[model samples]
Target: MTLSKKARSISALEIGLPIFAGKRFLDKDLNRCFGDLEASGTLIEEIRAQELAPLLKGTDILIDLHSTIKPSVPFVCVPKFDHPAAEIIPFFNTQHIITGDGLLTQDGKPIYADTFVNAHGGFGITVESGYENNSMLVELIRDSVISALKHLGVLQGKLECGLSRAVIEKTPYPLEECTIWDAYWNVIAGENFSWTKPWGNFDSMPAGTHFATSDSTKLVAEENSIILFPKDGANIIPGSEVCIIAKKQE
Candidate 1:
């Protein structure tokens, strides 16, 4: 299969740059990075139609690169049963599915392959490489890109094996049933709002234990389940509740 004419000449797509406004990088400076990297001058939508959409139209596979604040773990992103590419997605180490709804954005709409396919008419997958400054994670990112290319037959090589595969499945945890709570931004003296124990995505919080609180208000778990992405740090936003509580899938 032939890559879009532009993709053949242009190598990779790079987003989240221009550390400072009103500045441009020289070709040599950009060359310091791998592949044909270019600045996405505007929001992705602005250029998607004029540039990327065409390149992705006839394309069978796409690999989106992204980084997370917590770069210690690598994860693969797949749409919610909306695209054909999901069939070929390789399971990553992490079992969590980074749905568009879970992501932080000004637009409340979720970002999934369905949206991309509707606009570009192709299959694509997004991969979160890890934290921005971690050099070690960069190597992992490179390996993931290579593996994806090989899977698509864009590159030639013996594919590295995965430890195991984690299929994407969803078990809904209602807000009321999961003992929903909000993470406070500030703490005051004599206030009771505090996390008694650290919590994270897919972790279990015991029933009746103080999970979090707001201004002397106590929040306790009503049931035990996998904490699908906790509101730790700025990773989760205000008003968002625990979307899922992990129970044995029947």
Candidate 2:
């Protein structure tokens, strides 16, 4: 029922490849290594980005599907770099759509797969499908793909593609249509940080509410916002992103 288990239920890019078998990466977190052509190093991830960036550039409509560590309401991210994924945002079943005006970076450099693609000549999307235990994650992902393809005229008819017909028959494309602005979590002052509470995705808090603490100081929300991708307290590290502030897009 957790995201990790659901993530591994599917295969790698190639059929029957149990690529997600082990840790997320062999050397580094692959998601953070993208968007820098000048990024250099002997680290396997660094080298992989050097090779993969060029290949992902200029893709017309690319979807970087992901899941969150904490259980969440599925949503989509449209990075602030003039990304072109608006046409298909409403195609999926998710109601929450985030478009960040603030640029998210790691160590003063761009990070994230969709941002890399968006910076290039393409429509890039980062779709975070959260915890859903009732239905298979793979089938839900497939259904989204099929829906998007049909909306774009790429697929035709009620082609379930071997997914459960019962699930597909009740599929609803109607969305809550929340266009939200984004802010990264603010607990970056020190290491070994922990949240004030176990905050799940989309948990709302008022302005001035302190959500996290390291040492004796607690981090406060500057605006009334909802949380997204709240990392477990155990994973806290210096300069690491803890969560995101999803605010109403005005």
Question: Compared with the true structure, what per-residue lDDT tens digits does model 1 show for residues 163-187?
Answer: 2332222232232232322211111
Misplaced by over 4 Å in model 1 are 1-11, 20-61, 91-108, 112-121, 130-134, 156-198, 206-224, 228-250
153-245: candidate 2 lDDT, tens digit per residue: 554566645555633522555545555566554334365577788888888999998988766787788888887766663455466555667
| Backbone collisions counted per model | 4, 0
Q: Locate the minimum summed-lDDT window of 10 residues in model 2.
A: 8-17
Instruction: Identify the candidate with maximal TM-score.
Output: 2
lDDT of 1: 0.42
Backbone clash pairs for candidate 1 read 71-131, 201-229, 202-227, 226-246
